[model samples]
Target chain A: MKLEDATPIIQLGEHLLVSMQGDLDDRAVLQLESDITRSVSETQATGVLLELSGLTIIDSFIARVIARLAGMIRLLGAEVVVVGIQPAVAITLLELGIGMQHLRTALNAADGMALLHEIRE
Target chain B: MVLAIESPESVCSIDSEASLVTVRARVRATAVDLGFGIVDQTKLVTAASELARNVLRYAQRGRMIIEELDNGDRRGVRVTFEDSGPGIADVELALRDGYTTGDSLGIGLPGAKRLVDELTIDSRPGQGTTVVITAWDS
Candidate 1:
């Protein structure tokens, strides 16, 4: 499935922003990784901001895919930041033993963009 | 003496990726009906997602049963997943973190265990597997 059909990838001044809303099935999650990675390289973005406030749950599979996406974007020379993790999801992720230390994160979209800019500098 | 009351059980078939989403929604609705708090609801839904996916991944297809429980003082939700696939060879290893035979992160079983109040697994090498998880209102 095309990335646009699942989630839109918008370009914002050298950074690409993708907002994930609602429940995304396993196929969509995997598609997002490949789509985002390609968009980063094609756009030559300096950073990528993933907005995840609309996601109610992040299972192990989703978490692993997100982490892997971050690593892939970094290899393409762009930093990735995840923002808008709910308090409960954060607690559950920790309990699930997925710290996601390799990825940078912020509380919301504004903060995430700012962090991305700081990292790009 | 506290009497236990159970609501009518609902079952969802897990035969495709879309079924995974359906199961999570069903569990979330049941959790809400049981008066589970936000955190508890999220934990239960997340655990349901993991186990449902396991059914699709290992057995190729399975079914999940959701039921509401009340013991006069406490309310809870229980989800049971059953699949007729190649059963787990090592239940203990399967429940450990970072142990997987497929192309997954290997945290589904153990992680689901950590998210709820109770998790039980019954599997035979060649017969099938059954996993049940329960989370009480907190």
Candidate 2:
């Protein structure tokens, strides 16, 4: 099978922006580790913003990865925020208890950015 | 190197989707015996439970296929699950983490694929879904 790709983007700002595309498969998860590590390191962002609008599902394994990512970002003196999570996706994440620790979620990008701004002050 | 290992006992032929977590515990521990970590085992078991539960909930009945790699090159397991349910409307949309026909959290396939090294999904609207998952420890 062809390995799933990770569509991650990094920008310089108060919030580190990263988006994941394609299936969040094991390979993709592994790739995300390196991508996040690099992106979080080079950016001056104090918070991490995740856009899950493109993601339609939320498996437990992926939730674990997200939890781990959140922990990793916190170690860098930053926090993680999730956006565009559908109701069903949110339910699954809740079941897996993925983001119970210091996770801030938003209904849209605007809300996510606003939350970031709120945290900055 | 063809590492083909099969366990007939690992097959859980239940139709209750709500009982999935119980089965997950059973299967994950078995998979762990085959050289998987606690985290990896939990992921695989959870993924399997979600997939199998879909079968029970949507299709009402199905079979779970479990296979492990004996290849000297690597240590892994493959599970091919088949269900004769109402079928998926849109595979791409369904592949998304939140798109669900039922009231589930809609993370079964997406989450399952993420937990394993390899994932293959084939389904039709009325035919059913055949999901193949591969987990590796190598």
A39-62 in candidate 2: lDDT tens per residue? 777775688888876764556546
Whole-model alpha-carbon lDDT for candidate 1? 0.89
- For each candidate, give the TM-score of chain B: 0.94, 0.86
Which stretches in model 1 have alpha-carbon errors above 4 Å?
A1-5, B1-9
C-alpha root-mean-square deviation, candidate 1: 2.1
Residue by residue across A16-99, what tens digits does model 1's lDDT show?
A: 999987788889998788989999989999999999988899999889889889889889989889999999899889988889
Clashes of 2: 10
lDDT of each candidate versus the true structure: 0.89, 0.69
Residue range B1-138, candidate 1, lDDT tens digits: 334444455978899998988898899888888788889888999999999999999999999988777767798877899999999999999999999999898999999999999999999988899999988888
Best by lDDT: 1
- Lowest-sum lDDT 10-residue window in model 1 chain A: A1-10
Model 2 bad stretches (over 4 Å):
A1-98, A101-121
Q: TM-scores across all candidates?
A: 0.94, 0.53
